[model samples]
Target: MNGADAQSPVIVVGAGLAGLTCALDLVRAGLPVRVLEAADEVGGRVRTDRRDGFLLDRGFQVFNTSYPQVKRRIELPRLRLRPFTPGVLIHTAEGGRIRFTDPTRRPSDALALLTGKQDGKPGTGPGPLALAALGPLCALDLLAPPRLLKRLPELTTREELARWRVPDRVVDGFLRPFLAGVFLEDDLDTSSRMFHLTWRSMLRGTLTLPADGMGAVPRQLAEGLPPGCVERASPVAALSAAGVTFADGSAADARAVVVATDAAAARSLVPGLPAVATRTVTTYHHAATRSPLREPTLLLDARRRILNTCVLTEVAPTYSADGRALISTSVLGTDAPGREAALREVLAELYATGTRDWERVGTTTVAGALPAMVPPWPLSRTGRTASGVYVCGDHRATGSVQGAMASGTRTARELLADLRRP
Candidate 1:
């Protein structure tokens, strides 16, 4: 590298996936870089905490292998990801447990969910016709090109489902609750494009978690960078021509500054950035004596009492402490009066076990769990800012693991091209 390049390293604010990725790309391209993080560790919103030998992610999240960016950026085997059952179990208000399996993923289990005859029960499910319709819908989303999906008229997810003629029973009993957890909104107002892309990834990918925790994702990314590149506990205050001002009254000079925080933080850090509305979600972790239902598949409340619940330890034994099962349940908003009590009550009904003895390990409430995507949305962006600074995150593009890393990659290339322009 030139003497000038050596002196002025690129400064990256926020050591989340996007920031870590941007720094890694630039470092690999022979540029000196520094990453500043407000928090003590990486992963931003995608973080995990350890309590009593249990791994509690900030919220319920899974690593999707089918996300193009995930496959390209993350080393799957290194994570030792464990997949959930390719389906979900719905606990109806009527006290019946219904299973919905994705036939495309496991054809052998097709007969169960496809015909609505699980465990020799005829009327326990949504019926053959309605459930059968799902495969084609998922297949369409799985195979359709992004360009083609973008060309379609903009619509809310509810509208798109109506256009496809999905049965009300299937939607209300299953999709509605399932998607509430996915989009973090109960109304299904998320963009059809975003919904389709999310659904496509779910259909084509294995829903799994890293054995360590979600935080391990960003940790792996940060590890790839040169030592001392990421400076933790370093909060960036402002971006200036000389580079960045830290919250502690310190400053760092740089050739360029990139903001890679979450949507809210990014907007606060970079003035006049495009506004991205977001949704809130909270996850509660509880410890139980044994696994509930003996499967790692998500169990949804048909009554919508809780977004979804699962035995985390069933998916990964190491997530538990003292050989107890770890159960996690999420709801659509921040805390409220009697919310924890309500969560426990619903957990008992859903799991058919008394939660009186289960211990509440941790509760994580995320203000902006996901950006509210409404059409006409740009699935991807250039990460260019009007203030002459660079910005990248899930908020800049579609909200997902893919968007964060892809935005980081895009911003790095943009910065590299600018540096090369004589």
Candidate 2:
């Protein structure tokens, strides 16, 4: 099964999180690896740009400290992680702005979860059903054994939530809108298993950002490898079991090839792809002279046109070079060049502050942002294809840092095991 020749390097066709992890693992196992990246820098979709004096991430991304791969690979102290309020702010016509804190973690927020006082005032809580369901729901996700959880029948997230007896209003108002941002699917059609996994992580981890930006995450991962292991601005024109031809009429021979690019790119590189369905996400970054919603909490739209918006500067002051407030908002689909005026109107309502003077710093649309995890979704799949080569990315597993790195790790382990066999 090993297609590689002796002393030939394993050529990785991307320098994304999955690629970085795979190459790093390979190098650790005493294999020569060369990472080819089409972009000028590493990180692929997980990139940051300095523009208009703002640190704008390519998409709205957060670093969860609790991811196993992240904890094992990244040095938390180096990133200087900044935490967001472990709760959400739901903005709706019905309830202007409702805050829900994780009373379990933040005892200082210190009231009943639904009945908890927010912004230092008596707040109206949820009805009896939601109040009763909330704690046990989180507890089950948090405390249940992983093997037991996975054995449950696969269902759509919405269906599973209903089975748990979450009232329809709660699903529509909060769960749907909030999860839409996370899963990049507004319908909650993602797998219940994926939903529970994420819910458990959220309960256990702190939602955070690197002081510098999300880009630092992959940069940190790549830093461990030897110098020149990763080659930037190198695009792969075609792939074969023997080697890869570059877009520039050059070729590099290899023992094996790993297609670690996104799902679309992987399809072009490796044929007969898995059942991939993805949702696109577009994030709009606006710079404002005046701060809005000064707290470092994510604002979810219950009305649900814009999935969520946050004051980036509130979480990490380094995100803004000129100290102007950086507001980032994300929508469920792609390309909204014409929606500037309307987006501003939504921001105006959400923040209760006019966005007329806010400058649009950047618009980032990540096609295939997340793999669509419909009912009966496979939590993980074999990356080895019939073609004898391999593929790895978030799409090969679930979509998250954990998923991407785990895919890379699993593929590397598989590849290494094959090589070791007599």
Candidate 3:
């Protein structure tokens, strides 16, 4: 088994976004690579289904134009990005609505949005911090690793919002709702490192989605790979410097291997990967007889508990077949059995709809849907890199499609560099 023989072929495990993207990029760079997917298909967390002529995503998810890695790596035309309206309507238990908008794209304005209040007004009002955070949000090119690392251990999200004089009530009501939708946490319980980075990105990019569904992004990458590059449903049970073996007893000799699955799965596949924390989210997809509103998307900020109602139809009109709306209430930390009841109570309080109106078109409860993305985020959770092994996934970065891609690319790049070393 020499360098040109079967002994040293590069093997990438887990055909999720990161794995697929990493494998594709490496092959494009003139390196030979093979991808193994545990499931019958690719796109691990990004599962999309076409139901009765309507596209339904497995869980509630969305992306923004500001994702630097995704923008650089993905072909935009293939996925078709749809922008989210600038404003998000907040529906309350009293059947009252308050709409929040950012007036500036600069940091100061973004900072201002932090402190502004609802003033008992519904729609068309600027919160305090919305104005101050403008510059920071719009300047994400300046907000990457080095720049962000400077503000750590001190300039936290809570601290930054407080510095802008964001009113307590508004932070509880407005900022919390926005953050919850993004981080999938109720309060600002997530780490400041993650929140600050996210805030900067949101300020830089506009919210966008694919016309097909979230899965389309992963699907496009998978299709671009060489025909034999991917082997579906071949779960690798173990790996060594000499070769790899699958659950069915088939094996392939490889000089290098990369594990790009979820954190939990990675721990089992690799020898010394750390444990990854988990969080839960419940997504309620109801086809309202009427529309949730004429608007396609709204972000509701209730008390510190339930986060927001994401109106999917507003972002992409094709989600609903009969013009019936698809309103997804995304609740984090909510269990499967209790999610339906919780959503009903919240919706009835917010939209004035009774149990009768929310006719339950569909519901999905994703436990560990999103890894508990708090600070001290386990960067080393990806398995230990021994003689011929590497690791990559959203867990290796932030829990996002782009994060996954970036990690995978990093792994492949590292492996290639190692192979070329003298």
User: Which parts of model 3 are misplaced by more than 4 Å?
Assistant: 1-8, 92-95, 105-151, 154-156, 163-165, 378-384
lDDT of each: 0.85, 0.86, 0.68
Q: Which ten residues in a row have the lowest lDDT in candidate 2?
A: 109-118
How many clashes show up in model 3? 42
* TM-score, model 1 to reference: 0.95
lDDT of 1: 0.85
Per-residue accuracy of model 2 over 70-120 as CA lDDT, tens digit each: 989999999999999988888755555567677776776545445534566
Q: Write the per-residue lDDT of candidate 3 for residues 266-380, one digit (tens) a residue.
A: 7787776667787777676776766655665566855644656766777887777777667777777655666587667767666655645655666666666666666556432
Please identify which of the two predictions, 1 or 2, would achieve the higher TM-score against the true structure: 2
For model 1, the run of ten residues with the poorest summed lDDT: 1-10
Highest-scoring model, TM-score: 2
Q: Tell me how candidate 2 scores on lDDT.
A: 0.86
Error of 2 at 16 (Å): 0.6
